[model samples]
Target: MDKEKLAYFKEKLLKMRSELIDKLQKKYAEAIDIGKGDGLDSADEAYKIYNRNLMLGRVETDALKLRLVEDALKRIENGTYGICISCEEEIEEKRLEYVPFARYCTECKTELEKKGLIRM
Candidate 1:
């Protein structure tokens, strides 16, 4: 990729990582008191547990995305951005536009998904 494109993707990845970190911080704050209160009926307890689990799951997903964004930044620094890690081919611009932190092209991503490898 050209310097312009690489710069664009690096900027995008950095912005995304910042936003995700902010969101994750808020989520972690919200999850701090998960199922904390006592004197709750069965229904209330169940609801709290469910909400806690849901929030934790969302945070987990965000954390994973954050890691991907960080890795993409590393790739940019190593002069490997825009190249699919799996196939070593130039990833489609459209796909990169959609997912700036993608490590694989659409074909490889699809194959990985089919093999139950690419979670989220």
Candidate 2:
């Protein structure tokens, strides 16, 4: 890809990373507050548990996204941003458009899925 295209994808990934971080931070703070609340009612307990679980899931997803964005940025640095991680092949532009952080081409991604290793 040309430098302009690479920079475009980098911009998209950075925007996504920033949004994910903001959401994760906000949810994490809310979860902490819920944990500190003193109510012991059943509804309160359920809400706390739900919030905790949701926050945990969000944290994990956010961590993965952070890694993906970092990897993508590293790719930009190394001049390999739109290549498949498994096959070292060029990823489809359409796929990249849909998923700016994609690190695998369709074939490799399908193979990973067949191996029960789907990323998402």
Candidate 3:
């Protein structure tokens, strides 16, 4: 990709990374502030456990996305941002536009999914 396009994608990835970090921080704060409702009824205890689990899952997902964004930024620095890590081919522009942190082209990604090497 050209320098201009690379810069654009870098900006997008950085923005996404910032958002994910902010979300993770907020979730972490909430998790720390969560109290153990020792005196709560059974239904309330169940609800609290469910919400905590849901928040934790979201935090994990956001952390994964943040890592991907950081990896994409590193690839940009190495001049391999738009290339598929699995196939060593240039990823489609449309795919890059949609997922600026994609590590593989569609074909390679599909193959990995089929082989249970990666998940969506």
Per-prediction tally of clashes: 0, 0, 0
TM per candidate comes to 0.94, 0.89, 0.92
Whose TM-score is greatest here?
1
Cα lDDT computed for each candidate against the true fold: 0.92, 0.86, 0.89
- lDDT per residue, candidate 1, 8-120, as tens digits? 99889989999999999999888778858788999998999899999999999999999999999999999988899899999999999999998999999999999999875
Q: What tens digits encode model 3's per-residue C-alpha lDDT throughout 1-120?
A: 898999899999999998999999999778655545778888888888888888888889889988899999999998889999988999999999999999999999999999999974
What is the lDDT, from 0 to 100, of the residue 31 in candidate 3?
A: 66
Candidate 2: stretches off by over 4 Å: none
Candidate 3 TM-score versus the reference: 0.92
What shift in Å separates residue 49 of candidate 1 from its native position after superposition?
Answer: 1.1
Q: Rank the candidates by lDDT, best first.
A: 1, 3, 2
Answer with 1 or 3, whichever has the higher lDDT. 1
Residue pairs with colliding backbones in model 3 are none
Candidate 3 local Cα displacement, residue 36, angstroms: 4.0
TM-score of 1: 0.94
If both were scored by lDDT, which would come out higher, candidate 2 or candidate 3? 3
Task: Show model 3 residue runs off by greater than 4 Å.
Answer: none
